[model samples]
Each structure stands twice: as structure tokens, then as C-alpha cells.
Target: MTIRRLPQQVADAIAAGEVVERPASALKELIENALDAGSGRLGIEVRGAGRTLIRVVDDGAGIPAEELELAFQRHATSKVRSLADLEAISSLGFRGEALASLAAVADVECRSRGRRIRLLAGEVVESAAAVPVPGTVLEVRDLFANTPARLRFLKSDATELAACLKVVQAYSLLYPEVRFEYTNEGRVGLRTLGRGDATAAAAAVLGTAVAAELLPVEGEGIRGLTSQPRLHRGSRDSLLLAVNRRPIASRALGYAVEECYLGQLERGRYPIAVLELTVPPGELDVNVHPAKREVRFRDERVVFGRLQRAIRAALNGSQPYRMAEALSSAGSAWRTPQVHSAPAFAGLESVVAEAFPAAPGAEGPLRPLGQVQDAYLVAESGEGIVLVDQHAAHERVLYNRFLAQLRAGAGASQALLLPETVELEPAQTAAASDHRDWLAALGFELEEFGPQTVKLRAAPLATPAARAREALSELLQTLAHSLPQAALANAAASLACHSAVRFGDRLEPVEQRRLLEELEQAEESITCPHGRPTRLLLDWSQLKRHFRRNY
Candidate 1:
């Protein structure tokens, strides 16, 4: 093949593919332009999942009449003037490729300042005077019409709509001061009040119930919303981070938030957070991605430290967490208890020493009023009532304490009356020998009796002797497939599980109160080591709904 220069149209199409993959990509570029134009009110409307029409209206500075046609030309930007400007790029959309790329594949109509520019395949079909608005009303129709291959790659309407709304919702958080209205299929999907209130914006997007549980995070160069550890999602989709008003995806950025919640959120569960960071223009780079959704920072360590401290500080004095009760069982009979007519809580000495930083029930926030099925503890809280899972809650309390001990030193061990000899399969025996040090750290005193047998001499602290053999055997089996750190954690969780009191165990009123009190003291008492929630909060409204007490 001979070396040859690609035609301009072919080159433009290739460049367009990088910037405009779908309706959502085009929407993102336009939104960035609106924000950069100093738009205070952004209205976005879409139909057919943005394939038919993607319109964006912003109440910002309109483009000058003379510059209307040039705006669609490649690399023509008012954002940067010199080499120094490019190095310190601040605006969200700067490469000047968005409008050109969009026009390459779609029918674009741009009307601003009494001028009109109609484009198709990156060509100017018409340029004339027209009625103008105060800001920009840029509409893109027949998206990917000429680019049939790109159209084939798009997902269904529902999926694409969700992706587009995700981008809009992210901006809504970054700029709570800017009111936004999103309409899809001739109906309003999301609208946010531009009052600079992140909490209010959260309610609009995440619902009022979740917003009520969110805490305000503030720090140097950042402020946003973060939920309690108990209120978490199965995935990190709910976590949003924006740098300088640009929604970005950086594993390190999300990790910083997760690190602060290490002890609170168990494995596989992620917290919901909206962190907006503002760095000096020179310290951050947003040009790495064509979509402007990923950024690089000069000081990631500084950002990580600041964000972690901000979240922890925000959590200070925020009265612990209580799980929200759901209608899980079909017919679990319960009563609507009166609210807040008694003492909040009474203190108690934790039976398990050094189990938690604060005594769980010391403040008597939720008084243990009674029990249900000898397994669930019913409590009278300040708001309404609380349902505590006796077994799962106890597991959480012990798990955190046990994990902390294992990290501090070799865990405290309780000696057994007589050593129990356990027989393992060949694979399990090999795994046990490989993880022998880890087993010891988990407070297991074991010796290989044979190629397929081992003796369990002592159980980890808090684990009863009766279940010691079972716990050790489970640990060895887990060791076969787990990484070093994960295997240790699994072993600790196994020990905690075997030691926790059973669900059917009968508890006297005094014992119930004691358990509730200790729960309040654990570092993060939301979920057990195995990720099972310990308590369920039945707020006043739920009680009213069931009692038919609606006014």
C-alpha cells in the first residue's frame, strides 16, 4: 500500500466517531458548551432516546453573529488563545471538536444572535439571519443518520435514555446553583431547583427518603453529599464525582471515598456519594478523554487525603445508622408502637470488653421494649420503633471487634478442654498448610497430624469451643480459593459467625438491652461481617400505613 493522505470527509468522520458515539455523547458536548457559556438555567429535551432530536437551551451568552459559521469549524475555539492557555485549560469543552464532530454525522441547527447555521456532514448548507434568543438553542436531529455504522452500535431507547440522564444528573450535582429541566418523550423526567443546595438536588434524583439519610461533606476545595454506611448500593453506580464541574470517571477518585468507608460498608457493598472537587486550573487536566468524563490530577495523594478527611469530619456527631425496614415477609404481624414518650436510652457495660469504641446502648437511643419470635428485638426509638435482628446484629458487633484484634496482634484465643482432630480432603490439607500462618493469626492453634488431618487446639476469641471445629474447617475450605488478604478476612468472618448467638436463642429483657447497648458502640454496626443488616427502622409513616391511621 502507498502512503496517502486521507480525504477530509473521511478524516472528519473518524474524528466524529471518537467524540459522538451515541445520543448521550452529543448531549454531553452540548451541555459542556452551555455551562462554559455561563448558563445559569439549562433545559434539555430529548425524543426517541435522543436519536430523533437532542435539544439543549441555555440562558447564557449567545454567540456573536459574525462568529456563528466559524463556530462549527474544527479547532476554532474562544477558550484558548495561546500555548499557555492550552496548558491551563479550564473550560469543559475546548478542543473545538464537539460542534464539528456533531455536525459531521447529524443535522445540526444553531440559532443565536439573529443568525442561523444549518450543517450536514460537516458542511454549511445555509448561513443566514434569523430570530435570536437570549442564549443558545442548539438542536441536533437525525443523529448518526449519515453514519449508519454508528447507529447500529447504539443500545435500545430505555438504556440510552438512562445513560444520557446519568450525565445530566451528574451535572445537576456539580452545579446545584444552576437549575436544570430534562424532558424525555414529551414528559418531564428530572427537574432540579437551582438554589445551590446539594441535598435538595439529591431528593429530586434519588428520592426524598434517601436524601433524608444523606450527610453533608465539606472540605478544602470540595463540598457534596455522602450517605451513611448503612445506606448503600449493590454497585458503585450511585457514586458520582465531578472535578471542576465535569463529571469524571477515575478509579482512584472513587477509591478515596470507599477508603473512608472501609469499616462501615462490608465487602461487595458500596456507599452512595456525590463529591464535587474544585482544583486550581493548573493542577488538573481534563483533556485526556474525548467525552470529558475522566481527568488526571497533579496531586492525587492530596485529593485523596482531603476527600477522606472531609467525609470523616462530616460524619462526626452524626448519630449512628439504623436500617430502613422493608416489607420483606408477606405477613409478619407487628404493632404500631407509640413514639418518644419515654427516656431515649439508658447506659450499660458491654459484656464483651473492648468490643467497640462507644457503648452501643449507653445513650439508650432505642430502648429495648420487647422481642418477637425470640429472635427479633422490638425497641421504642425517638422517631417510632426499631426492629433489631438478634443474631445478625450480634455478628456485626463481634466481627468488627474480631477484625480489629486480628489486625492489632494475634487475636486473643480461648483454649479448648480437649483438642479436636479434624480430617480434611487432600486439597483442604494442602491449603491449610499454605495458610498456616494466617490460621494462627486468626487465633487458631493448629498442628498437621497427617497429610489429610489437623488438630484444632484453640478457637479464636469470642468463638465458643463447641463450634471451633466447624469454624476451623470452614476457614480451611475457604483458604483453597482465596487470596492471602481475603483468606484472612474470610477466616475472621467464619470465626465470628460460629461465635455469634443463634437466632432462636431466648433472651431475657436484661440480655436484650445489653445486646442493643453494645451494638450502639461498635465502630460500624450497620451490617454483619457477611453483609447481613442487623437492624430495621420502622419509621412513623410505615406504622401509620399499616395501622390505617392516615389522616
Candidate 2:
């Protein structure tokens, strides 16, 4: 077969396919164009998730009537005039493919006034017989109508709308000086006024709940913030990133964000963040991908390091809820003791004594705080209060025990009274099967029953039967992902939480005292596994201030 040129319309439609994946993508391109045009106020209205109609009105420097047609031509751009301009790309939509691609697959009607023309003179001009306005007004309709395959790939209206909102939120952070309004199906969805502060703009887009949880992130050169540990969500979709005012996604940056909060958050949870990095345009490569999602920095490691520091600083500065204090308060007959001096182990001794008072030369440090609030332990002595997170402590204890048992080949496992069977997804079953030896060493006996089921014959005797099943399943999942040994420590902590007595659970004074004694014996009793302080020291000065007696 002889090679021949493709039809112009077919070629154009194919080009559109590259840049326009869905209605949201189209909206993103238009918004970028408006922003590049120095739009101070943007209004967006969508119908049918931008499939039936999408319109964007911007009050900016308008294009001349003659240049309006040129705007829809491929490679025609006002943003660049020479090859050197590529090195310092300052505009958001410099490629000039957006309007051409959009017009190729949909009906695009645009009207604009020239800088020399009066507003009244250019108010009623027509383009393809479409109505005109003073500033730029772009109307896109019947998107992907000519390409049915594209329509098939599009998600539902609600999903597409969510994608559109995400795009708007990202850009909103980059240009806080521009007021933005979005309307879907004739109902107002979001409105962000020009605030000139990125955090304030983010709050307008992401809502106050997320905004409140976010800690301001500012590095020496880069500026941004990451969300607190408790505010982490299931997906990394909440990351809003902009490089020199251009909204783009970088996998390396995403990984850097995850690495920053590696120890702070649990498995499968991602922190929400909006990061703005300002580097000289010449030091970055923006033309790496067709859609321009990925970017390459001159000093990739430097960028990653900066991101890590910013996120870490933000997390470190934020206040975390003290779970151990809550547990101690819930326990009956527990009192916070005062510290008169700063001894080497004053605080630890006080914590142990309060948690577990000595009975005239008690043996082996009062049996170590076992479990308080069903998750932590309280031990008190003369120095202060020692609040221990049972889960973290148990994790450390059990990890060493499990490792020793594995090496000794004499690990003990207690037979279950009744065999327990757990059903998992095929992937989970595969993950569990791969880590059978590790499970055995951890004191879990398991055998595959069917395609997606496992039968458990025994579990660690130290762990409660009620919590064994959940712990086994969690361990299997963790092992499947090849998580580090540190993850097992976290799992152990979770297990301790499940088996320990919980807050609001009525406990006799003796039981509470016994739990406190156990905490005193445990090492690292100052905090829980998650790094929350186990005990809070309210000083005499603070107490006086609370009662207004200091004056």
C-alpha cells in the first residue's frame, strides 16, 4: 500500500485526541489560555460535564478581531517568537495547540476585541455567526462528538465534574490574584476571590476542614505546606502542585512527598499538600511529555531534598492530639504528679509510680505497664508520669521476641480453640502465600484452603483471640506489599490497641493500677508508637495561671 497524507479533518481530530482526553481536559486547556492572557476574573459554566457545552468568560487583554481566527491555527502563538524563548517559558499555555485541538473535535465560538478597538465598537462582531462580547468569550460545544471512541473513554458526568474541580483548584493556587467562579448545571459550585495568598486561595478551593489540617510549608527557596498526619487520605489525588505558576504533575515530586511523611502516616494513606516551587525556568524541562505532566529539573536531587524538608518542617510544627493523656484521664484513680527537679529519670519514675505504685520493694519493676485505655499504659513515680503507648511498646517487645524466636527455632504458638478461616481477594491470597515462613515466625499458622481463602490453626499466645484474626489479616496484607520490618512494629502496636482495655471501659482501681505497673516496667514509656506524648506535664505555674492566682 502506498503512503498518503491523512485527511485534514481526520488529522486535526487525531491531534485533538492527544490533548483532549475528556471534558475536564478541555476545560483545563481553556482556563490555562485565559490565565495566560492575563485574565483577572474568570467565569466558567459547564453543562453535561462540558460534553454538551462549556463556556469561559475572562476579562483580559482581548485579541484583535483578525487574530481571533489565527488563535485556532496550530503552532500559532503570541507567547513565543523564537527558539530561545522555549528555555524561559513563563506563560501557562504557550504550545498554541489548545484552541486548534479543541476546535477540531468540537464547535468553538470565540469573540474578542482588539486593544485599539473601543468596547462598544467591537461588542457585536460575529465569528462563524456566533454572538460576540467585548472581552474574550470562548464557547465549546459537542466535544468529542466527531470522535465517538473518545466519548466511550470518558467517565461519568459526576466523575468528570470532580476532575474539572481538581484542575480549577490547582490553578487557583498558582494565581491567587485572579478571582475564579465555577458553575455546573446552572448551580454555583465554587467561587474564589482574589486573595494574593496561596494558603487563603487553597482554603477557598479545598474547604476549611482540609485547610485547617494543613500546616504552612515554606523552605528557603520553595514555598508550600503539607497536611497533618491525621488528615491523610486514601489517595494522593489531593496533591496540588505548581512549578513557576504552571500546574503540572511530577511523579518524582509525589514520591518525595510520600517519603517526607513515611514514618508519620500509616500504610495506604497519603498526605494532602499544595506545593509551589520557584526555580529559574532555564533549569527545568517542561517538554518532557506529550501532555506536559512530567518535568525534569536541572538538579533533581536538590528539588526532592527541598520538598522533603518543607513537608517535614510543616508536620513537625503542627500540634498532634495526645492519645495517651486521654487514656490516662479515662482510667479511674489516676493522678498527675508534680516534678520538683529535672533528674535523669525523674519524669520516668514519676510516670511509673503514678501508673503502678510500689508495694514495699516490688519485684521486677512492677510488671511493666501492659495496656492502658485498651491501647496505652500509665506508670508513675516521684519524678513525673510515664505514659506508654502499649501498641508501640508491644511492637518493639514482640518484634525482638519474634526475631529471637525465629533464630532459636523454638517459637511458641498456641493452638486455637476453633479453627478460623479468612477470605481474601486473589491478590491478597497471593501476598499471604508468599510470606508463609514470615507468618510462622510471627506465631501465625496458616494454610491455603482455596483460591482466595486461608485457614488459621494457631496464633501467638500473647495476643488475644478476639484480635488474632484481624492481626493475621493485616500482617498478610503488609507482607504482600513487601513493607519493611518497621511496618510489623506498627502492626504490633495496632494489635496492642485492640487487645488493651479502651477508654470509656469501666475498670476497677486494682486493674488500672496493675496496667500502670506494667507501663512502668516497659522501656520507652514516654510516648506511644505513633510518637504522641504519653503524659502531659502541667506545671504549678500553669496551674496557677488557670486559676487566675498568678497575678
Candidate 3:
């Protein structure tokens, strides 16, 4: 066989494969085009999970009647003309291949003011005059229809719809001044205000409940929203990040956000945020990927440090953190796990009831005075004072018990009146399936209810009914992102954190004493499962030194 040049249609379809990986990919391109045209209002409608149809109507500058046909040609663009223009590319869709690629594999109908251009297999087959508008109404139908192989790669309606909604939500944060509406199968999923209030838009996109808990963060060139420790998720699914009002994926930015929440939130849980960084166009490169989702920065370390410091300030100012609460005696940082030789009660063959052995005194080491902020238990000791983290103390106690029960192959399983159901993501669902027996061994009686949902009939740990759903979900998410050996510790830590006493809860004197007793009994009473100090000790000598007292 002799080598020959491929047809233009074949090349266009191949390019389409790069930009139109899925429905969300095409939707993102259309959105960028709409934004570049200065659309104040963007309306989107999807059918059959965006495989059958995706229509976008924008109120921006429309194409001229004569240029409608030329718009679909390969490499045709008005955004950039020379190589120098690529350095300072400001527009989102400057590559100009998105439209051509989308048109190559799908039936495209473009409607402008008094003109309609239709394409079939990347060719302009029909051009006619239509009713006029100031913007563009682009309709893409039968996506991957010409390429049946690509059509087969589509996922379930729910999953694909989630993906498309994620794109819309991200862009909504990028341009709060643009009124955005998304309708799936004629049902409106999201609608945002266009008054340039990012807060209101945030509340509309991420439910008013979560939006209310977001902390405002601002730095030299970065400004956006971040969630308080209480308003976090099992995964970074809702972390919306953008640069210059264009949503992009940057691992550095994601890590910077998480680093701010380091000791505040438990392991495996991520904070909710929409961080928008404003950088000079020349300092950033957006041409890394065909979809333009990834970007490169010139001074990443400096920018990352700025983002880290800004978010850390916001988190620190929001409330008193666990580390700060215990820092009086536990040193400047959280407890380090290496301080313990091994798990105090490693194999759990035989249990030690007195985990925190009593000293030679009737009142013992801790004498309860009262609660501080309704969170920590203030106690009097031979030392100046002891501030006991009620949540951390309870967490330490429960973790040892849960792990011991796991070693015993079965702990006391507490059944719920109504079987609680939790819906997992696709990846989590797969992880749960792979480790079903391991979870069962850890005292969880879970069964697959549906493709992506699980039913929890019984739990080993004494978790509340209201928290059972979230507790199990976070545990699975922890296991989903860990290795086999380390995953067990992550799971145990998650269970303890979720089942332990929460901050801001009122505790009676008797309950407080019981918690102290149980916590003392744990082998590793110094630190919680995740290496947070359970109590801080301030001796009399240290207290006296502050007052300049010499004895």
C-alpha cells in the first residue's frame, strides 16, 4: 500500500477527538466562546445527557452574515493573528480549533442576526437568512453520531450530567457578572445573578447553607471564597478555581488551599473554595492542553506562598483552632506520632482498662473546673491548669476501641432503626466493591443498594443516626485515596473523628468525667488517631515564670 494524504474531513474528526472528549468538553468551549463575545447572559439547555443535543444562546457580539460560513473553516479565528499574540493570549478560546472540531463530528446549526449556517461532516451544506439577534445561538446535535465508536464511550446520564454541571458551576464563579442558566431535560439545575456579587452567585451555586459558612479571602492578586472547617467535603469536588475569570486545573493551587486547612480539618476531608487568581497574561501560559484546563505559571513558588498565606489568615481569623487551643502546653504544632514507640495497644489480645493510670491522689491528675467555650474541659491539677480537648480525648478513646474490635474480627455492631443509605461517586463505588470484606471486618455491614449507592444496616462504632451517612461516606473516601496497608489506619481515624464528641456540644459534669476516664484508659492517650494532642499540660513552674515568681 502507498502512503497518501488524508482527507480534510478525517483530519477534522481527529481534532474533534482532542477537544470534544466528552459533553463537558464541548460545553466548556462554547462557554469560552460566549464569554469572549462579551455575553452578559448565557443560556444552556441539554438533552439526553448532552449526547443528543447541547444548545447555547448568548447575548454577545454576533457573527456577520457573510462570515458565518467561514467561521467553520479549519484554523479560522479572529482572536490571534501572529506568534507574538500567543504570548499574551487573553481570550479563553484563542486556539480557534474548538468550533471546527465540534462541527467536524456533530451536526452544527449556527444562528446569527438574520443568518443561519448549517454544517454536515465539517462542510457548509446550507446557508440561509434567518431572524436576527445581537448574539450567537449555536446548537450542536447528534454528538459523536457520525463516529459511533466515540458515542459508546459516554457514561450514565447522572454521571455525565454531574460533569456538565461542574463546568457550568466553575464558570459561574469565574464571571459573576454574567447571568448563567443551565437546564437539563427542561429542568433548571442552576441559575445565577448577574449583578457582579460573587457572594450571591456563590450562595446560588453551592447552596445557601454552605455559602454562609465561606470565609472571605484576599491577597495581592488572589481573591475568592473559602470554607470554614465545619463546611468541608470528603473530596475536592466543589473546589472551584479560576485565573483571570477563566477556570483552569492547577494542582499547585489545590494543594495551597489544602495546606491552609492542614490541622483544622481531618485527613481525607477537603475544604470548599472558589479561589480566583489575577495574574498578568504574560506571566501565565494557558496553551498547555487542548482543552486549556491546565496552566503554567512563571513564579509558581511565590504565587503558591501568597495563596497559602492568604487562606491561612482567613482560616486562623475565622475561629480558635485545635492547635491554638492546645498550644499552651503541647508545643507550637500538633502532636507528632513518632513520639510514641508503637501503638500502645497494638494487637488487642488483652485490654488494659486503666489506659491513663491514676497518680497517687484521690482527685487524681485532673480535677474538672468547668467547660471553656462549651468545647474544652477546664481542669485543675498539681500543674497550673490543664485544657483537655473534649473532642480529641473522645476521639482517642473511640479509635483504640474500634481498632481493637477490628483485630477481634467483629466488634459490637449497632443496628439502626432505618437502614441508612449513602451514595458514592463512581471511583468510590469501585473502591468499596474492591474492599467489601475489609470494611465488613471493620464492623460495617454494607451492601450495594444501586450502582452508586450503599445501604448501611449496622456499624461497629457507636455513631449517631444523623451522622451515620456522612461518617460512612468520609470513611470510604479516605479508603478510596489510600494504599492497602495505610488505608486501614485512615479508615479507623475517620471513624473515630466522626463518632467522637463534637465541639460546641454541652457536656454534663458526669459525662465529662466519664470521657476523661475513658480517654485515660486508652494506650495512646497523648495524641488522637491523627496526631492531635488530647490535652495540654501547663505546670506551676512554667506558669510562675510568666508572672516573674521565684520559689
Strongest candidate by lDDT = 1
Tell me the tens digit of each residue's lDDT in model 2 across 448-550.
7887888888987766787778877776665556556454554445444444444545555576565455544544443344434344333334334444576
Off by over 4 Å in 2: 114-134, 322-389, 393-551
- Please list the C-alpha lDDT of all candidates, in the order they appear: 0.78, 0.66, 0.77
Model 2 residue 139 CA deviation (Å) reads 0.7
Range of the 10 consecutive residues with the lowest summed lDDT in candidate 2: 327-336
lDDT of 3 by residue, 129-224 (tens): 998987999999989989889889899988788788878888887788999999999999889988898888887786564566678888878899
By lDDT rank, best first, the candidates go 1, 3, 2
TM-score of each: 0.83, 0.64, 0.63
Per-residue lDDT of candidate 1, residues 1-551 (tens digit): 99999988889989999999989899999998999999999999999899999999999898999998899999988898887886777788888899999999999999888898999999999989898788999999999999898899999998898888887887887888899999998898889999988888887776665677679988998889888665677678888888877778889989888867765666777777888888888898777877777788998999988888898898765764533322111220111112221122211121111112222443248788898888899888666566778998788777776677767666678788999999998778888878666667668898778878888888787787888898888767777767764665666676677788887889998989888888877755766776666766655654564555778
Spell out the clash pairs found in candidate 3.
Answer: 355-521, 356-520
